[model samples]
Target: MPKLDLGLPSYDSLFSTEEERQESKLEKIVSIPIDKISDFKNHPFHVTMDEDMLKLIDSIKENGILIPALVRPKDDGTYEMISGHRRKFAMSHIGLKEMTVIVRELDDDQATILMVDSNIQRENIYPSERGYAYKMRLEAMKHQGKTIDDFENDIPVEYNKTTSAQVGRKPETADVLGNQLGVSRNQIRRFIRLTYLIEPLQEMVDGRHESEIKIAFNPAVELSFLTTDEQYDLADAIVANDRTPSLAQCQEFKRLSHDGELTTEFIQETLEKEKPNQKEKLSFKMSEIDQYFPKDFTPNRKKDLIIHLLENWARKKSREQER
Candidate 1:
């Protein structure tokens, strides 16, 4: 009897295909020279050598970079890093000449969206970073033809079906952006306002300098409305007085700016105004001085006694100076 020849399929024939081979080649990681990779333009996120960064560096040194950074090729033949700025910095600090990167083709809007989304997941993000990132991503989304109605289903039917003139009157972008960021729409708007601040004022808003007074988010947002020259003048006043504006003071600054009367002197005087919290207070733990006072004595009695003793001590000092 003649046996029919039935050839078993080879492993290569079953598993290997042209499309699979192309995909495998695309997924391959390559080491690019560190010098060839440039930082993303106007990267809102900052890479600091803080304790967390030091730990990251140590981990990279002990076990080489486990994940490759994402980068896009530029027309100038250099790669622009989309994510992993800190990883790249750590590798460079570890004396690495080349770093592993996965190169992909991405347009400007796509790259901006990816960059902002990736960095927003970090544990610590400054107000300025969040502001610029949200702004960039919002712009990118708009550029990609995503309208506020796409992400927000809560829009009224009437509003959705409105004419172009009516649609232009809606400010639903903030609501859509806020939904993605897990914040109120107003909060998203406030953060986006920080992007208008100049670099110096923005750094102060970030609280990067220990010696400089840190501006709170609300006041910083208000300050962002100032013109470029006014912001510079306010920065100078902040440094000169070593003080930041309170929310109320910032409102005054904004009002003056709107009236075209905001000057360095106005900024200085507004910042110098004493806030309620700035008032001096004598603080003491109750346990520290409780033994000196009777158990039944009320707080008011204790305060009165302390005041009396201070008055007598002042009198004694005055007498000594006269003698």
Candidate 2:
């Protein structure tokens, strides 16, 4: 018996001409004029003409771009770069007029996820790059109603059930993103917080400015809470005093700022004081050393044990040196 044709057509057949369906099925990769590609809007990663770029240029000269860049078409007859800012940059530097790209039709959020995953795993990503990239991708994931489960293939799957077990509740957006990026929850929080920093202070965090000392990462995060004018005041004081605030000093600054007690003169006075590195004492956070101790050990007991072990190790090292 013939099956009754339900007066219904397949959605594809109903919506499209045969040519449009065929075009959708065709291969997406194509060579296009380099000028037709635009850099990703608000791209976070930097493409410096440094040793890395020189190395990349050399690699392309020898083998060509082994991987096609990913791009998305725009209404303006141009393409927005998604995953190959560095490659595009290298080809441009090499004076190549046309390049290979795989054109993907993705919305903003999906494109952001693809773009971030492409660059975040590179060996040389700076803190600022990771900061902004993680922020962008995390927001994109949340916007798309995604979770850590959706990101398995984009990153190495390292979600160990026994070791990485969460307590109390389901993971939040930042926690999900941190796991995807292999960043710890607390550390990822700090990195995302860096996006709130002003441009000059952010550059100081990157430690690339010739005129100023590199602000320590924790101290910089502490400073991100200050009002804009307060931050400028702090920056001027840092330059005038030839010193960056220590983490402790920045913590104090944060406290004062919250209490409406911070001022330009006070900031100068703080940075002008002796830096924490000049002090004789060394400090360690519990998180850094907790793995070496048993769960029941108290802080004082741990400190005593550490000192005893260090003394024995030093004496043994001295005897080895004499021998």
Candidate 1 structure quality by residue, lDDT tens digits, 1-323: 99766897667876777658667446446899999999999899889899999999999989999989999888888899998899999999989999899988789999998999889878889899998888888888888887642321113333345442334355576667667768776566678788888988888988985556688988898888788999998888788777787898888888888889888877777767767776677898878888999999988999899999999999999999999
TM-scores for all candidates? Answer: 0.73, 0.74
Please give, for residues 145-239, the per-residue lDDT of candidate 2 as tens digits: 86533321112235558877554546778777777778876577677667777887888899876775688788888888888899999888877
Residue pairs in clash, model 2? none
By lDDT, the best candidate is 2
The whole-model lDDT of each prediction reads 0.82, 0.84
By how many angstroms RMSD does model 2 differ from the true structure?
Answer: 13.8
